[model samples]
Target chain A: MIELVLSFLKLGAVSYGGGWTIVGLIRTEVLRQGWLDEGAFRDLVAIAQVTPGPVALNAATLVGHKVGGLAGSALATLSVVTVPILASLALGALISRLGPRGNRFREALRSGTFGLLAMTVWAFAPEAARDPFAAGLALGAFGLAAFTKANPVLLILGAGALKLLASFVLA
Target chain B: MQASKPPSPLRLFLFFARISAVTLGGGYVLVPVIARGLERKGWMEEKDFFSLFGAAQSLPGPIGLNAALFAGRALAGLPGLFASALGVLVPPFAAILLVSEAIGVVAAQKQARAFLDGAFAVVPGLVAALLWRMIRTRAWNPGRVVLALAAAAAMILAPGWAPAFFFAAAALGWFVETPGTKA
Candidate 1:
């Protein structure tokens, strides 16, 4: 339990950019530590996405539960959030103190986020490419999301429904 | 109609909880959804909200959760912060717990597995769309674009050095100013 909390704490502290980047980081650490196998990790990722909240947090909760039940879930969730919450508080204070100059710092961070997100998308590409049907769905979803103002929740549901239909046909 | 009195901590908590519960695409997409809700409620002005948002982006953690913390702090102080954080976090915790418990049964069904695969596959596209939107909306420059592409390439070529990539990007960003902005 302590190890689980400590591992997630490290992840929460170091993870930047976005959830996908965090997911990548979590995947690496979990796999390295023999916490979860590749297949289990993929399922966790999928479950994290379909459910609400940050992928990292969901992953932590799920992984923690798997490892140590309810107590682990609480510990993991708390550990994952502690640094972020503290950082947010500190940053919030600093921003107010810095005033307009803070905008520059914020912009820099935003740039970093963009870069990280781009890397994350790149990392995810191979997994996405593994299945042709999934790839097609991904592209179509991208088009829909990019061009239209469709709700992502609706799009996710639609994707699930489409997949179910596809499975029936294939079966 | 704006309430003459500030919202109670419970109200703040519930509001954030609702937002977190319904939000699908994760933290990046939470901004607009939050802004819209806060605006509708007259809880925050546009300028204040964006500034908070900018700060949230600059901070660590999930942007959505960070935003909630900031907003909650702004709205009602420490109590509000606790309330909002709990509100935003609870639903996801419950949902993930429920799903994890049921995954044993769910994974066994081939159709369910396919459905999940299909849904998970679109995640990359959704992220791509987000990237495209970010580029389109932000003031872009040659240097920033190059850095982004380089970062992507680095991740592809050397997955092991992923952590270094983030640090390097931030370092690059610190030096690279936004286009048309004076140093």
Candidate 2:
């Protein structure tokens, strides 16, 4: 239990970029602790996605609920967000010395964010591409999302429907 | 939209709560909704809200949550900040908690399982798309390119200590981007 809080606290501290990067961090840590298996973890991530809110926050809440019930849910949710809230309070104003350096600093973080995001992609790829159909769905999603302004929720739902239909026909 | 008088914390809370409840796609999607809603309500202009967003990004945490915290503060100080946090957080937690129980029943269906598998499959592609956009938008020189590749390699190799590598990369970015700040 203590380990759970400690890990989230640490995870929250460096969860730069956005929800996906944070999700990768949580997935790695949760798996490391043996709290859940990969298939289970992937299911949780799916649930996290369609549900409202930040995916990482939802992931934390769900993982917490799975491991330790309601109390765990609350603690993990709050714990994961603790540093971000504090950082917002403490440093939100500081960003706007608004000088040239401020903008440059944001630029500076981009390389690392890019790296973190790269790692996130690396982590998710093989698992997402394990089967040819799955690979096709993922590639199609990439093309649609990258090239057009298609909504993600629709993409996810559409992918799910396609798979359900495929199962009916294939089976 | 003209700037109105400061909204009450409850108003801020309820406002964010509505956005939190309705917005489906997560932070990147949610943040824009908040921006627009705030603008429509005359709470903060889009430009000011986005400037705060820029600051919020530098800090850790999800962009939507951080944006809420900053926007709340900008609009109504500490009370607004806390209210916005609770607003953004509470609905989702409650909703998930309720869904968590129901998910078991839903997961039992074979069709549902197939659907979930397919939904989950596109996650990597979505993530890759996001990275592609990030890469495209950022100002990158050859030095930054080498640095980014190195950082990505190091993080992939040692993800457990990824934060350290990321911060190190950030410092290196500062060094490389800021020509002649090496006094």
DockQ of each: 0.56, 0.65
Q: Name model 1 segments beyond 4 Å from true.
A: A14-17, A96-100, B1-3, B40-42, B178-183
Per-residue CA lDDT of model 1 for B1-183, tens digit only, reads: 564466678998899889888777677667788888887888887678887776666667877888888888888887888898898789999887778789979978898888777777777788788788887887777877776777767755675565667668767876776433532
Give Cα distance to truth, residue A142, candidate 1, Å: 1.7
List the candidate 2 regions with Cα displacement exceeding 4 Å.
B179-183
Q: What share of the true interface contacts does each candidate keep?
A: 0.59, 0.75
TM-score of each model's B chain? Answer: 0.82, 0.91
Candidate 2, A36-142: lDDT as tens digits: 99988888988888889988889999998988889989989999899998988887788766467776676677777777788877887888898999999999999
Provide the overall lDDT of each model, using Cα atoms, as 2-decimal numbers: 0.76, 0.86
**What is the Cα-based lDDT of residue B51 in candidate 1?**
77
Q: At residue A3, what lDDT does model 2 achieve?
A: 78
| Candidate 1 chain A least-lDDT 10 residues | A14-23
Number of the predicted model whose lDDT against the real structure is largest: 2
Q: Please provide, for model 2 over B85-147, each residue's C-alpha lDDT reduced to its tens digit, 9 standing for 90 to 100.
A: 999999899999998898889877899988988999999899889989878877677878988
